[model samples]
Target chain A: MWRIAIYETVYIIIYGLYTVFEFICGMFEYVYQTVFFTCHEFLFPSEKRARLKELVSKIKKKPKHLTVLLGPEDAEVTDLANLVIWCLASQIVFISFYDHKGSLKKKEEKLQLEVKKHSGDTAQVIWYTDENSNLENGFKGSKVHVKIITDEDSKMSAATITKLLVESENEDFTIENIHKHFVKQFRFPDPEMGILFGKDYCFYNYPPWQMRLTEFFRFKSAKSITYAQFLNLLVKFSQREQRLGK
Target chain B: MSWVVDNQLTRFQKFCVNVIKCGPIPRHIAIIMDGNRRYAIRNKMGKTEGHTKGFERLAECLLWCRELGVKEVTVYAFSIENFNRTIEEVDTLMSLAKEKFERVFEEKDKIMMEGIKIRVIGNLSLVPEDIRILLAKSVLLTKDNDKSILNIAFSYTARDEIVHSMKTVVEGLESKKIKPADVDADLISYCMYSNQSPDPDILIRTSGEVRLSDFLLWQISQHTQICFTSVLWPDFSIWHLLGCIFKYQRAFPGLKKYADECQSNRKKLNDRITSFLGDIEKKRMEQMEIYAKT
Candidate 1:
């Protein structure tokens, strides 16, 4: 018992010294990084973005077919766009959905600028919510190949969704028909997968067809919320190992 | 004719409508309502005054939620950690809760008496004797209220809930009331503070923070979460509440999960309703035609 007491005393002293060292290291680490991500990044009293960053970098090495959903007003989107272009330029598939309205001339011009900025060398698909276009309640349908959902106003159909649903089902309900319908709504001729961004998870049902038990991550911000953070989100989601049949 | 498809859809607007239409809307919604001090200081006020204003806001929000079909609303009124605050402010908060609860008991107002049941969740072991007794009486009198439930997580926590359940479950096992095989997540959950309330369908927080802060930690899962940063708790209005619900609808879209793509294999739920409505419309039209022909 006395030996145990001495062991505990030595253990406490060593841990105490280790704790002090960690505190000093933590202060220096935080001091180095001033400009972090958005308000949600700092919401946690404990700033632990480093663990998230480490995970994101791990995913980047394996480099699966990745998509980055873009928000129009956020600085984080710009930071991400730049990160992909500068670092893992070939690894990522940067996608965006912005307002493709106004004069046919002005809309096209705006799309050109946005595509150039956000898409880098990656492919771009601008949102089309026009009359002749196929959409089920603004977004969703058989025609869409890629589903890029973000919290942008011009991208969602709002309350007119009921009408969009009515239109999507103008024909008889069939599996092949529904598949065709979704393809038309997304407007992406060959969109293989869908990606939801972490910036604004206020999903107004974009790509309403595809998001059946899809994995999601409320990611850390862009600047300081490193590539490893994104990688970690993917890793955590991959490990969940759920069967969708239920 | 007003269906102008030329205009574009914004992300926030679409997100709002989709989530509300999804699953069963929560009849009783609970919240932590944290960051009033941070919010108040951001608006330039003393820390102590923030809680005072948040209290008044809480009173008004109860009426608003009741009117909006929220049967019950629970909030973390005070926590065990809150006892660590300055003695003067903690005393002031205790007195305020006692005074408010007393009025709720005495007031014959329909809003106070009708169906709205109020309960407090926490360890009462540490509360003052008078305050604890008053709480008990308030819970007793409000037991018959059927309209809604308002649960306050004062000094409540998930860890305590787990410990409390463990003790009870252990006793049951020792007494041979429940077998070991019956031990599961559901059994432990049934013994939780939120077992009386349906799992919160939607959890909303204000002042823009996203962490759960140990509030309803066990009860919330896959529930639509909405955190509005710009709105403070006191100024949290009906309009904003509508916005939150609408946003909740947009988040969950309930569309695809129902789609199944195999329409024939799946039960036609909506088409059945639409067909029913169509038959009613048809019968009415036929009767009107018969009348017109006559």
Candidate 2:
């Protein structure tokens, strides 16, 4: 009984010491993180662009397909233009864009011209929601393909697909059939990397049919997006070994 | 630290709580509590100890959610793939689960008093029969409670859930209870393991893991705001949750619009199916009336 009491006392003392030490460490960590985050918020815009550029140049393996999700407020023609230039420079073969409100029609012409001018190599641009053009004419021949996804397109495709499912043979509609319809309707490439340019890490219902296994990277703001951030995201994605839910 | 410092920390936490409560908080939050084993390794403790600490943290987190006014919280407690681990580890986990479930039963009165509803989702058949019984008992005890919900995903995977849902639909069809025209997104969703709760508005994955690991893949991938943190599950704090809420608040407007769009899409599909069903029902009623007259 005495031995047991002595052991318990020693254990209690050690445990108490550990708890106090952890508490002190936690306080220090909290203070350090708060200061660092505050400073970064003020200096991130200017420093991040240069760091991202350096990181991009260091990346040896570039992602084949990259998708960018623009916040409702960040969906500007100029931002898209910068993205196109960065993609062309990095040799990222395919880029897809989705705006929350789906208002890219007014910027299509300017976007196309900007891409043509900035795209040193050949590239094909298609509006996924374009009613006049069929799938055959959409991507006839191009080294790079850019598709602008919109809400209207998704709604139309969803209606047609649901109609097809309802008409199909008894309760046999499965994931494959739904997936096939989505692929045929949207013709989207499976993006290996997805970059979200906003504070929140969300897809915002952007082409939900794809992006099952895409690696997502969140940037603080989309207002002053730099190639470096894009490059950093790519490098980070390349380093990741996606288990794909295995 | 001195009492003054501790008081200041509490004040700061309260301030953050006030700010988070100002905006539209997420109705449902799903968490993938990862990195317990890593925490064990880092802290030089046994794996079981890490899990025990994680459980304690989870209990604290549930109380935090209750205080934060979060209605529903679902946690990825165990994945279907976790069964593939070494026999010893699996045994440990099963026993742990049994103990936790038993504890729930032991605390039935307190749980009831708190209005907590505990639900265990996933295929219970795969669990040890004894643990499964304990789980069911806890769930039964908490069945009437409605203040808050806690969904524990055990031996669960989103694909398995989807497959099970599909099987349910197929069975319904085979029995002639459901027509091909009646099948829609909402119907399929209702058959999922998570049908008991609404789709998570915000998802959190801890331990620096960016992938979903097959948690709620079909439900929340489109519209849910996800926050990934490097903190181990045992180390997760209310401050981390608050930061995530701040992020969610910033993105809520766009997310809400997207959610509205998805709802409208589902509504349109449902409307089409409903009209078809209405026609069929009308014909069936007419035939029944004529037969009755005869």
Candidate 3:
């Protein structure tokens, strides 16, 4: 009888402990979800989203062309696709991605497909891996036009521009004329701002001509870019006063 | 405890020094000496007093550059826009330039002994005549020294330099000394303010400003790596300068390759232009000979 009584007491204690453990786990899960939701919501603030939408909707001027430099890190193609989708949602008409090395062929193809699937014929996405590509072809309509610039593009641009300037100046060349012709021929627009998503805040030669008056914004890493980060960057860029090399 | 921490920091700095030495060093450096007025305002000091402190800092920076094996240093001393400031400020700056140039002239022997070549690159005609004379004398004194170059851009603006080059090119075209076909980037570069100095490899601007500020705009477009810092000019230290060099080292290989490619491209075009000019000269000489015989 005594042995039976001891077993009953131990069984009660074990059951009580099990109940406490389950309660603790439940509390932890609830806290975890609350923290995650808060962080997620912080990036998607209603006020900031409203400000960005309002600023972009003004139609007061053409949407500013922004170029983003990807660093040496192996950022996923899905992240790039997400960035494009967010940019479209935010009403940024033109976006450019410049990498120092040439774009990965398979990855670029996949990215193009993904972008096409997302935006359909509404967006013109061109992967410019070399100088021979038709650089002056697009930027019509109200669609978002995305251009992927590789190192080869910058090299070719420099070489071709220099050759054209040198050859034409012999005929009738002034700096002003060279610039006008180059702009018209290359269809190059001076980027209003360049966002460098690299570990180190450095320009990896993002086509020197396009960056003459560009205000550069640097971020630590672009591996997992969120929509809130993109809109926040645009908000910050709107507030920056460009002296234009006074 | 503080002494121990200092020792560890010193050891780390030495490690950085060793790492930097293993890489290629920048041969030429350009500095936009900015933020003197801001520094003065922050410190509640007079503007001229801030400038005086800046000069002292420059002297120390020169020694640091020399130690780092930098062959040339260019300082953007005064921009043309500076004249638009209050007359009191302008007069103070001009007097300061005169004093500094006079000192450099007075120490001509020491400058020559160190093989330091000092050149003033700007539209010097705008400067007061006495200061211009002193600048000319200083340049003449240090013309032969080849050890190091100190280019002081006084009364200078990049746009003015480009315009001057264009005018010179036009004059050449009119004189028929050079044909229109021969005008290229190389020829234009040769006509700029710092023609004697190679393009700067590293450009450092203080006071956290990131723009080029119209300083060396054309020359630096090729492959120059820029470093911007928040430290005021007066507080710029050797460590900051070394940190900049380390950043340059990181960028050196890629930039050097690009610069080399550009050089080769220019060389090819220059050669073609040269051969064309030579052929033209040959034809003219043959025509002259025929005319003589006739």
Candidate 4:
């Protein structure tokens, strides 16, 4: 009985200590991230621009298509607009914003306006779902093409695509042809990188079909996403090697 | 000499695990086991030897998971893209897989006693006949075990799984059994190879890789906790798994909230879709029947 009591006591003590340690570490991380974000925010516009440019230069390879997965807390239009402007500055051709609730999609016009305000008059922003958006044109004149997706898009696309295939005269369904249909439906290439802004690491039903090779980077919260952190993700993405099962 | 130390270490590990069991435990876990070749190179061993070590590590991890009360484990054993590797390496991997399956079959009694069901997910037609037969037999042998599930993703890719589900849906539509309106996210999910299990609570990828690498893309929801560690597959230890579980527990409350919200939203969407389909349901069914007859 005494031995069992001693073992239980030891277990409790160790577990308690570990939990406390984890709490302390989490607090430290929160403090560090806040301080880092504030430091970047305090930088002069010119200095920040220079820093962004430097970071972009350091990236040897950049993803042409980027998807941002936003948590409920991070679904602010202004923050998304800032992200779009940053992507435009970095020359990413395609950007997709995914929020599970479709809140961002509802505020698309506001997001577009905010992006345009920061991206300048010369930068053309094309919404992929717009009637004028042509898949073949492929960001020819547009500085960046944006697509705002929600859970509905993923579910609807699958149903719609399946219906199209079933209705079509062709009996054969190959991956190549199915992929073509999806590309046509999406009007954007598959995302090469996915940036998640949330307290937890979850995709929230970000399009499964397009994320086969997407390298995901996570930020603690999307509310105060800094340019430096964004640039760092880009650099990290560039450095990582993808074997694609080779 | 080492047996004594190992026994003592296992006792300590049991104590740790018992304490961990006091918290919220993940019901399902997925793993992307990577970096075998790198581990081999680092240790100056043959690549095959590293793979063997990785398999050993998997056994250890599964034991730990079972002790920790995880009911389902899905492992990325092989990918469809892995067929592009050198012929010799691919051959070795197939043989290794066959040998492992045979061993599992030989230990069927033990597996049955443990109530562990074995499932091989993915495009099985792509594998060789002999290995396919072995996998089928192993799955059959353990099909009745319901306490736990071990999903081995062989010849699998998320895209292919999606495509497979699409093909199934197409077949259903062609047969006039289900109309186009019947197809939805839940339908696609049901047709997926992993339809038997719930979405994983934790996804751990070894070797510091940050990508999903075409593993369970359709099933990963906002509730899943993803952990990427730098440790290679052969070097992965119980501590790493415990750490992952610890993180999951720490984030469980928030994850549960999001999961509940998603579930409710999905229910609402399904209701809306059903209501929307109600108006045109007859016409779609008639059209589907006409198409099927033709």
Report the number of the highest-DockQ candidate: 4
**TM-scores of the models, in the order given:** 0.47, 0.71, 0.67, 0.86
Candidate 3's residue-wise lDDT over A65-134, tens digit each?
7778785566677778777776676667667787665554447778877777886665555544334444
The candidate with the higher lDDT, 1 or 3, is 3
Where does candidate 2 clash, by residue pair? A52-A228, A53-A228
Root-mean-square deviation of each candidate, in angstroms? 24.1, 12.1, 15.4, 6.9
- Residue B246 local lDDT, model 3: 68
**TM-score head-to-head 2 vs 4, winner:** 4
Q: Per-model C-alpha lDDT, please?
A: 0.49, 0.71, 0.67, 0.79
lDDT of 2 by residue, A1-246 (tens): 675555456545644675698679867866765686557656786776566667876786766778878765646677788887777677787788877655666678778887777665545544444654323444444555678777644434454455454446435545565567667877766677888776567766555446656777877556655555567677888787754323
* Model 3, runs deviating above 4 Å: A1-63, A70-116, A119-189, A197-210, A220-224, A235-239, A242-246, B1-23, B83-88, B123-131, B157-191, B251-294
Q: Which ten residues in a row have the lowest lDDT in candidate 1 chain B?
A: B1-10
Clashing residue pairs found in predicted model 3: none
Please list the residue runs of candidate 2 whose C-alpha ends up more than 4 Å from where it truly belongs after superposition. Answer: A1-54, A105-110, A121-142, A150-186, A207-209, A220-223, A243-246, B1-24, B84-88, B123-131, B162-187, B250-294
**Ranking of models by TM-score:** 4, 2, 3, 1
The candidate 3 chain A region of ten consecutive residues with least summed lDDT is: A152-161
**Reference-based TM-score, model 2:** 0.71
Task: Give DockQ for candidates 1 onward, in order.
Answer: 0.02, 0.15, 0.05, 0.50
**Residue range B1-294, candidate 3, lDDT tens digits:** 000011223555544444455558788999998878789999999999999888878876776666557989999998876777778888999888878877885666667677888777887767777777777777766767898888999888765676555555555565566676566656666656676678889889898765665577667756777787889999887789877886676566667776786677664446644554454445433543443233
Show the lowest summed lDDT stretch of 10 residues, model 3 chain B. Answer: B1-10
